[model samples]
Target: MHPSTPGSTDQHVLHSAAQWLSAGSPVWLATVVATYGSSPRPVGSLLAWSADFGMAGSLSGGCVEEDLIARLRAGQVDGGQPQLLLFGDNAAEQARYRLPCGGHLQILLQRLGKDDLAGIQQMLAWLSSRTPFVREVSLHASGQRLTLLQHDSPQTCRLTSEYFIQPFQPAYQLLIVGAGEVARHLAALAQPAGFAVTICDHREEFLQGFDAPGAELRCAMPDTLISQRFADSHSAIVALAHDPRLDDMAMLDAFDTRAFYIGAMGSLATSAKRRERLTGLGVSSTQLQRLHAPIGLDIGSKTPYEIALSVLAHLLAERPQRS
Candidate 1:
């Protein structure tokens, strides 16, 4: 599956591939097209393959993916023009694929090759630069070829693709305003959920207090740090510190870009005060609307860990609604 966070899709594919290859099995990748009735994996979930076996990201909890892997190893994927794989559903009879339960899913498995490896590499590069890509792959009885297309507005180029289209967006980036305990907690929680998290603070003392795994630490001025590095819609900016100087300028810079979610951590009183200060500094109402002050949802979070969960939950809640 493609993640909005940078590099996670390619990372998962490569990781799964390595795992399969290490076990001396040829691998195939199965992608989900549609889902119904409480499916475990969503539309874009992925399953990796090797000749012997495979591991799926979230496809079918080892039941379906394992079965698919066995079929792939036995050269069973050599049938059907547009193969239809069903899981958790037993309603209709398609001559191609079927599932026992009504949790219907559609999957297409293509054998991996050198060209596929190159395509994954290219997708990884675009993700690293925070670029949105809509990848179209042409599949044959043998292999697949990919073309990378940029994601733009509705008025953008029209696709006349005869091949299948797989859209990939880099994950939302986290710009942690303060590198404190709460920031560390948030950053650590975000990575596996496929968020690329970065912590920014000028104070070495505060920055040194963090040691979150998979988070990028930046001990630089927040404004310049964000301006140089973050400038895309696939980012979420947050001001976590209780300091105006540290959070204000960086958030202002974030306003100039297409960052999807902008938030701040504080109480209702603190948020009101912060709002007044920001208005005094000329932050417009529209820009202010982008801010999620009194950050996180009404989860009654008190401790750092609980606050972190609230913050991430709010992020997920807002993601599907983002423009």
Candidate 2:
């Protein structure tokens, strides 16, 4: 993550790496190919770096990167071949690396040259189109190599003797309709969780009242934004306007998209009334079922901050399942 942004996405890392390659900098891409037990970073976590281009992602969010960099500089972990480095295997190793208790991480570290730039750009192009793809790393007698394959759906990140495979897609986005304190708080909280947030409000005056760092603000109709941008499997739509004129209209277009999560901010009673109103407006039973009124978990949220917390939690829980 940069100092200006709340968090970094894998797509951002890939783009940064590509930029470094274009500059003729020697770069290396690190991926957490396997995690066992209480790992800090999940499998498929990515980090791309160059001695001159700087670093873009995090594998452990701890001392692993620093240690690996030191090792690489000292000529300890280099042979110009893709290698799997294991960390936190035992108590001594755990203490040395500051890994979580019982946590083990297996990292696939590869050195990339100009030859890989074409494939990297192709992957970036696929991501730009919001397409999912599989990055297959194969172990061979000479060294580990990679291939990029287009995929319709995301697959589990797994490693075997012959290959380390991971599915990748575009960054997950959150389109929030109507701007208010809750919207402000949600945008702030969701960004750190790796959700790129966009807030849209038709109310020009109301739109002036909301502000959050790294959140894209739009003073336009919801249909144009939802249909054009948020109509993807990697999107989550939330109507927080609390105004039926805005929220319901947003809902009408949202249900037609492939957004994985669709919700509205309201109480139980208000949600029931909302369901009735949407049904009367010709929302199908299936579409209505997809809507999560009284959005967020039953976390007993009271303040705007707490409500945003609950909503982000719900999104994080359902993120992998749906998207």
Candidate 3:
């Protein structure tokens, strides 16, 4: 699967459920509702099970999933009503589940009825559309209910004794404004790290031999593509083209966007000259400050791959933290 594929692990479970449903099998979905201490999976991590396909996704590294599957097969969790199961509260239970550092987890298990299937299908649609949303599961005295709320930013999954809310956001994207060796290496590294990678270069020859799996290649002008395709907050724009004509133009366009990270690859002297040129072109001080020139960390990198690693390391540090 592409690293930037939407929904992450939760999406995997949903896809598995859809497949099992299509094959005329009943599916069970499990979500981590809450975690105390050092759980293997975060809140909202998912697992799916069907008699035909066995299981998909995971709730723990191994043992918790095994126990969940065993219990399902033994008819211990057969009721259609949603149930919350706790694991690793005691030393023996912790050893039984092999939870790391005695972590405790609360799991919400639900059988896929007709309505649940419809909801899963809807969630899949939203994920495919790259729409951000929140799935709220309420376990109240009245009954258990699931609701979807539209939102721009994904909220952290949280349990408040009555409700469990898990937010879903679109995948992160990286727009590389060059097809050079550094750009190629960076694209390869970013793709596996869950970035939707796109490489843009007007130089057709440079792009012709580029080989980064799962990255979209664009032969259009870098600046135009940056402005058109990467105006989102979750996007990062990096100019790795050695030519100032290309890199400067892309950086100018990037400054006008909400892209979280805007960077240019160059030496310190080259970056200083570029900054002067950009300032003369009417770029504000604040926007210029956002540009990561001499891009990448000060790792004393010389080779193309090493430079790519440094750039990726800096990007990871600059990325917004999610709860």
| Candidate 1 residue lDDT tens string, 22-109 | 5555556676756665565555566665645536464655567666766765777763333556665564431123343556676766
How does candidate 1 fare on TM-score?
0.82
Evaluate all candidate structures by whole-model CA lDDT and list the values in order.
Answer: 0.68, 0.82, 0.81
- What global local distance difference test value does model 2 have? 0.82
User: How accurate locally is residue 244 in candidate 3, as Cα lDDT from 0 to 100?
Assistant: 94
What are the clashing pairs of model 2? none
| Model 3 TM-score (2 dp) | 0.88
Q: Give the alpha carbon lDDT tens digit for every residue of 72-114 in model 3.
A: 9999974556789999999999988899776899898877755
Model 2 residue 102 lDDT? Answer: 84
Q: Per-prediction TM-score, please?
A: 0.82, 0.89, 0.88
| Runs of candidate 2 exceeding 4 Å displacement | 1-7, 141-154
Please give the lDDT score at residue 116 for candidate 3.
Answer: 66
2 versus 3: better TM-score goes to: 2
In model 3, which residue pairs have backbone atoms overlapping below 3 Å?
none
| 168: Cα error in model 3, Å | 1.4
